[model samples]
Target: MKKILPLLLIVLFSCSVHSQLNRTFMGKDIQYIEKNLKMKANKVQNLDNGLSRVIFIKEKDLGSSTIAKGEGTLDPMTTPPVSKKEYYTFILDNEGKVIRTDYQKEYEKK
Candidate 1:
C-alpha cells in the first residue's frame, strides 16, 4: 500500500496543478486583452463545445480619429454584435502574448 499511496498523491497533485494552470491562463488572457487591446472583457468561460471564450468590448480609440469627423466611427455606438466572420480564441503563453489564435466558425443548423 505504500507505493499505491504515493501514486495516488501524485495523481491528485497533478490534477490540482492542471486546474490552477487553466485558471492562470485565463487570467493572463484577461489581463492581456485589457492592457493591450484596451477593452473591458467579460468574464471568461468555457463553452460546452470546449472552447474558452471571452467577449472584449472596445473601450478606447487608439488612432481612429478623422480630421473632419472627430473620433472615427470605429467605436461601436452601441454594443457591437459578435462577428461571425471575425472572432479569435487566443492561446496565450505564460507571458500572456498570444501564442496562437483559433478562429471560430458560425454555427449552422442542418
Candidate 2:
C-alpha cells in the first residue's frame, strides 16, 4: 500500500508539470507571433508538413467618395481595393516566428 501511494503521487505530480509546460509553450508562441509578425493572432491550427494556420480580421472603409455624405452620385466601384489585408494563415516555428507565408495563389496546369 505504501509503495502504491508513492507511485500515484509521482504520476499526479508529473501530469501537473506537463500541463504547466504546455501552457508556457503556448504563451511563448503567442508572444513570438505578436512581436515578430506584429499581429494579434490566437488559436493556431496545425496542418500537415509541420505548418500552423493563424487567422486575423481587419476593418476598412469603402472609399472616400462612398464615405462622403454629399457626393456627385456615388458610382458603385467594381471591387473596391482591399484597404486592409486579412492574414488567413501564417506558418510559424516553435518560437512562433513566421518561417513561411502563403497568399492567394492558385495552381494552374497547362
Candidate 3:
C-alpha cells in the first residue's frame, strides 16, 4: 500500500491545483480578489451605475488539427486549429467589493 499512498496524494494535489475558483470571495474587496486570483485580468470595464466588471481569461492550446491545403482542398470536410478559452467575470460595487461572479468556457477556431 506504500505505492498507493503516494499515487493518492498526487491525485488529490493535482485535482486541487486545477479546480475552478470558488465564490468564497463574495462581498470581499477587489484587492482580496486579486490576491486569491493569482493572475491579472485580461480586461476590466466600467459599467452603468456603480458597478464595474472584471474579466480574467485563460487559453489552452488544443494542438494543430488543420488539414493539408491541397489534400483537403477538394474535400468539404476539414478541421481547423482550435483553442479553449475560459472566462471569469466579476462584478464589483462602487466600493470595489465583489457583488457577483460568472464563468464561461468556449472553444474558438484559429
Q: Can you list the residue pairs that collide in candidate 1?
A: none
Model 2: lDDT of residue 81: 39
Residue 57 error, candidate 2, Å: 2.6
TM-score of 2: 0.36
Query: Which scores greater on TM-score, model 1 or model 2?
Result: 2
10 residues in a row with least lDDT, candidate 3 = 14-23
Model 3 Cα lDDT, one tens digit per residue, 55-107: 88888878665465665366554576789998878899999988787777799
Runs in model 2 lying further than 4 Å from the true structure: 1-30, 36-39, 63-85, 103-110
TM-score of each: 0.27, 0.36, 0.60
lDDT of 1 at 18: 43
Candidate 2 lDDT over 36-84, as tens digits, reads 5456764578877666666544334444333444556655434443454
Clashing pairs in 3: none
Please report the candidate that would top lDDT against the real structure. 3
lDDT of 2: 0.52
* Candidate 1 wrongly placed segments (more than 4 Å): 1-28, 47-51, 57-86, 91-100, 103-110
